[model samples]
Target: MKLRIAILGTRGIPNNYGGFEHISEYVSEGLVKKGHSVAVYNSHNHSYTASNWNGVDIVHCYDPEYLLGAAGQFAYDFNCIMDARKRKFDVVLIMGYTSSSIWGMLYPKNSAIITNMDGLEWKRSKYSKPVQRFLKYAEKLAVKYSGSYISDSRVIKTYLKDKYAIDSRYIPYGADLFTDFEREQFDQSALLKEDYFLLMARMEPENNIETILEGFSSSTSHKKFKVLGDTGNRFGKFITHKFKKDDRIQFKGPIFDNAAVRSLQNNSYLYFHGHSVGGTNPSLLEAMASEALIAAHDNPFNKSVLNADAFYFNNAAEVRHLVENVQRHDTEKTMVQNNLQKIQYQFNWEKVINEYEEFILECHKKNIHEKVIPGNR
Candidate 1:
């Protein structure tokens, strides 16, 4: 049966930035290809109208500062949920549960709510105490009220099950969109001459940018480190200045285009992923797709995503040890290449979409059965 679906939260279908937005675009396009009617709510800040973008409907949510930063994201997400509730969509797939919990609770009867609680947002070190408390409350409400919840990592799924007694479906983010660009496209010689290690993240405290830079700079090995992505908060600027004079560290700031990021990922010999919070980082997955030798922080989230394949580090000592040891193994490069090949096949969008289609259909059938049972009604 053809289903009418609307993906709510983040910026809509074109997916100009970030992980959830990318998921929205891919899943919506995938559903449309399967003959399902799909609509996506776009933030009004981007100059797109109510037109079909790649065979799916685009509904705009009005907000002037929608593209600003984290604050803008919260506002845009809230508006998206409000707009989604007004639409007659059969299934509403909300990206983040904390921001949309109120709307999910008030959703009309019989509407199947599938909230993708992307990660443990309430546990992030970036948010203030009050905000974190509010998010925790909101997350609880979202899990308790939704018909179903989706988790991107086993760690997060376990958290949800333990906290709310909700067994969320594990639907991890796929890395199929990442491309292994030709090495000739990037200035590999220049990157190598700079003697820089690469790190890409949102420049938040929880991402542990400071610790990574500190470890890299203090290391006896003389290698520069280039940090990408925006310092979205005041703390980022403070940390940047603290490590500014270290000739071994360079902050490249944020690069907007996806292709450019792919080029960076492809050419880098090593990728440093220090995210201490969140689950299944899109950037890390993309780096893995590019076959970069990963040196990730020791966390359950990273372990689950990498399947314990990448080098894990808990402190500066471990980071230094991995940096020194990585070059000793001549077969490491081949192993990384093989891992990328495996990841490409395992994390393809077609397979992910197929699973989504089946799950949605099953949920719909179950909802129909509930409606038919007289006593249950």
Candidate 2:
């Protein structure tokens, strides 16, 4: 069935933002190519000002987020929902609930509403207790309002089933296989292949950025440690100031160039993934696709994706030990190869798009059937 879909809950695509936007970009384009009509809601302040991207329609909503800080997200989400009410979309896919679930009641009732229940936001260490409580309420509201739900990790799917009795669909994030350049050195800096370490993520408490940095700083290795993300935020500033004394650590800021990012991941001797609260992180998938030797924080979300193919670390000491001890042995090569195979067979973009299309079609058909039968409710 050719479905008309509208995607919301991101800063909007050509992906200058994080995971939600990244997936939205690929999913929208992919759906359009499959004879489906898709529209992505972009923020007015987004860099790309176009009305269309590829064959998908782009609806720009007024976003005061730049001026209002955190409060701006509510306004942006409100605008998107209000605009969606006027569209003819058969499926309205809300990507996350952190800033948008409060308006769940205002969502287009005619469309089959599907919420992508992102990682347990209330568990993030970055949020205060009061904020966490509010996020819990928001999650409940999202479940109450959406016609269907999607969980990116199996852990989250199980949690939703256990906590709310909601059987959410499990759809993990996808990544592209890194084949741009074979042995292409990261030309952004003077760093050589297999000589430096890498960590790319937003600077946040839940991400265990401080823990990773502390471990790297204490390690005896002479390799340069590169941290890539915008370090202008409060936590980022704190991390930069705290690690300034360590000359080996370098803050590279945000790098959006796909080739450069993949090259850096491909060339790094060890790539550290410190995310502890998310469900199937996009960066982790990209690292796996790049064949990067991963050292992830020991957590269910990361473990579900990496399994035994990646080295796990719990504390700063473990990080330091891994940093000092891990070498390019035959096992390491085997692990990297295994991760690449997972990317090709399981987490590739084609599989993700196909799964999404099938899921959306299924939800739409159920909604239509329910409306006709009424007793099917």
RMSD (Å) of each candidate, 1 decimal = 2.7, 1.4
Question: Model 1, residue 372: what's the lDDT?
Answer: 79
* Model 2 stretches with alpha carbons more than 4 Å out: 180-189
lDDT (10s digit) by residue, model 1, range 1-377: 99888888766657656888878888889999999999888877665565889999988886545356556666666777667667777787778866667555565456677888878888898888998998888787787667777888889999988988888888777775454354555555555632457899887788877777777767776766778977656877887889878877777888866666666766565788999887777788788877677888888888877764677888777777766556726676765775687567766678778878887777667667777784543
**TM-score against truth, every candidate:** 0.90, 0.98
Q: Residue 296 lDDT in model 2?
A: 96
Residues 26-67 of candidate 2: C-alpha lDDT, one tens digit per residue: 999999999999999999999999999999899999999899
lDDT of model 2 at residue 199? Answer: 96
Q: The CA-based lDDT of model 2 is what? A: 0.93
TM-score of 2: 0.98
Alpha carbon lDDT of each predicted model: 0.75, 0.93
Clashes of 1: 0
